[model samples]
Target: MPLLEAHGLIKSFGGLRATDTVDLAVEPGTVHALIGPNGAGKSTLVNLLSGRILPDAGRIVLQGQDISKAPAYRRVQMGIAYTFQITSVFPNMTIEANVELAAMARHKARDAMAQAVDHALETVGLSDRRQQLAGDLAYGHQRLLEIALGIVQKPSLLILDEPTQGLGDAEVQWFVDLLKSLRSETTLLLIEHNMDVVMAVADTITVLQFGRVLASGDPESIQSNAAVQSAYLGG
Candidate 1:
């Protein structure tokens, strides 16, 4: 069975239907990229999947259990980790503390939590700055810290929204490498605007347009899809 599945999800915002009867499945141990133009309801769809918002109709199943109505924190505890499009680290907290909080949410033993925090920080290349205040970090590092927070949860599915939004080329490359490394350990659901990164790591690509799935396929097929090319890929 798919690790995560959303069947006929529908979310409307007054006059606009943000998402319309969308069906999506994410397999285990693979990177699934969600891409589209800015107002394509990508954010709304993600919000629903993460349980930050409720879908007007439809159900979300993860590992055979229904989670459509679960709260965001509940989803996090149920192996869903999310890193936002914008950094949301606690400025007053130390970097290690930020990650520790995530680990604590899953009820890890003290020792285990420390180990998870350490590993997550190390994985995100933030080990050396573990004691630094989060607000003191550069924007790129802040983004990395956000990623560390998500990884500390050790989720079955990690959703990253615009992970490389504001970074230099070098930082973007680092993120690419990190994404590749992460794929081996956990399934990734990425909403990224960077086509290069999307093409590089995504095992499956799904394109949305006006709240509907326009195309979904392997990278080569998505690249060649006439609808996808004209819609968001700038044909």
Candidate 2:
């Protein structure tokens, strides 16, 4: 069975449907990229999967168990961790403190959790600024902190939404490399706009247009898909 599966997912706001009968499957140890134009409901779908928004109709199965009605915290406990497009950290607390809190939440221990925090900071290359307040870090570092929090719990599936949104070229490349290195440890569901990054790292690409899946295939096939080119690649 797939590590994660979404079957006939639907979400509607009054009369308009944001997600229209979307079906997706993600296997373990692969990076699955969800790409689309603006207003294509990529974020909405992410929200639904993460339990931030319940779908109107669908079956969300994780590790062969139905999680369609699970709450956000419950989903996290079940190994579904989602990092938002916007950075989310404790502005008043140091990076170490923020990460330590996440680690504590995961393990319910103190000293060992502190060590886990250190490990996560080091993994994200934020150990040097461990004492710096989260808000004082550079934007790229803040983005890294968001990812660090997501993985601090060591979830089976990690979902990232536009993790490189505002970074410059070098920073974006760094983030891409960071993501590439994670495939061995966890399955990643990424929603991103940069075609270059997607082409470089995504094992499978699923295109969303107007809240519906337009095309899905391996990276090379998606790159050469005429429909994907017109809908999102823009010639």
Error of 1 at 103 (Å): 1.5
User: Which parts of model 2 have CA positions greater than 4 angstroms off?
Assistant: none
lDDT (10s digit) by residue, model 2, range 129-219: 9999998988989999998898787879999999999989999998989999888778999999998999888999999998899999999
Model 1, C-alpha of 56: deviation from truth (Å): 0.3
- Please report how far candidate 1 places residue 215 from its true position, in Å: 0.7
Task: Give each model a TM-score.
Answer: 0.98, 0.97
- The per-model lDDT (C-alpha) reads 0.92, 0.90
Per-residue lDDT over 53-166 for candidate 1, one digit per residue giving the tens place of the 0 to 100 score: 999999999999999989999999999998888677999999988998878877558888888898899999999999999999999899999899899988999999999997
State which candidate has the highest TM-score: 1
Clashes of each: 0, 0
